[model samples]
Target: MSDLAALYSEIEQKTSTFCTTYSIACAQGCGTCCEHFMPDITASEARLVGAYLLFIKKDFSLIEKVRQSIGNQEGPCPLYRFDSPFHCSVYPARPLICRLFGACAYQGKNGFAVFRRCKYNEEKTMPEHIDFHSEVPVMQDYSYLLRSLDDQEGEVGFLPEKVASMLDQLQFLAVMLDMDDTNPDDTPNPMAS
Candidate 1:
């Protein structure tokens, strides 16, 4: 696996550990966060997700739908399958923001880190003496890692440029593998009700 892929795996492990330790439970089938927010991601992170799509041979039409949805300010995440059952289609390759969305720590006004519990995880209680600074993966640290790897300007929103770049990268990989670009009109949209 590439360095970026390894880092992503590490991130997944850490976040999973954090959530498990904290008993943070996101409400199943409730995609309020995914519907309301588009995650910020770095170029390297984008590349990883793109690579995964290519590896899975995801339909170009579905990818195009996601690309189009990326620009929709009011729409849910393109990767989120909202119709049959709301879930991330690319959950394994989701960005850091998505992985750590509900279970993270933020620096407080006093420059100390504190646990930022998800509003949806009402049943979980944060421990008083938990070490937020060391336990939780800091966003800045991951951002720095991605910047070092890709050296591209990080994107802060679900912008077209970022999605386009990811698509281009995924297409490039597909081309390298000599994969046929079949007509994707028959591919069903996951967001369609």
Candidate 2:
């Protein structure tokens, strides 16, 4: 749990730095990105989310909610729970992918610019005073930082089912083990495995 808390703190700092650099005003009670689906969580993140749910004893409710939500759709997301005022219940332990969202992007060698916008800002146009193209930093750079977080083989992609069951529990243990293996540096590593 301490490792998970530290991980949240680390990412929170990164996200705060990002918002500061771009002058983005994203805060709790802001609930802008909470309404949509987060499609790119790593296995480690999924596990943390699951642990949060289980720790809160919302596991069965989360599972049932996810099941109901994915009737025709797909759901590898066990932390895809509901909350009031448009927020995720398991937000604290949500994946790094979710943290890296909003400003994250991907570019092709052919110079195709791809933007990943949060659902919160999708239809709601930016205020008339803002210049989104020039003012905000692209999400691509943040993604590079996230890529360095994992010790997996290949690019990390979202696979909720792979992490939806017992596997998620394992990731929680992995995060704890990681903390145990590290020396007490200012910046703690969340997982050893």
lDDT of 1 by residue, 1-193 (tens): 2776788788788767876877756666666777777776677666666666655746566577767765577547777777756477777778777766666566566666566656655555544334455546666567667666665454445533466686676665555455545323333323343
Using lDDT as the measure, which candidate wins?
1
Q: Model 1 off-target regions past 4 Å? A: 84-86, 120-135, 153-160, 172-177, 181-193
Weakest lDDT window of 10 consecutive positions for candidate 1: 182-191
Residue pairs of candidate 1 with colliding backbone atoms: none
Model 2 per-residue lDDT at 154 = 22
lDDT of 2: 0.49
lDDT of 2 by residue, 20-42 (tens): 65444544455544444435655
TM-score leader: 1
Per-candidate local distance difference test = 0.63, 0.49
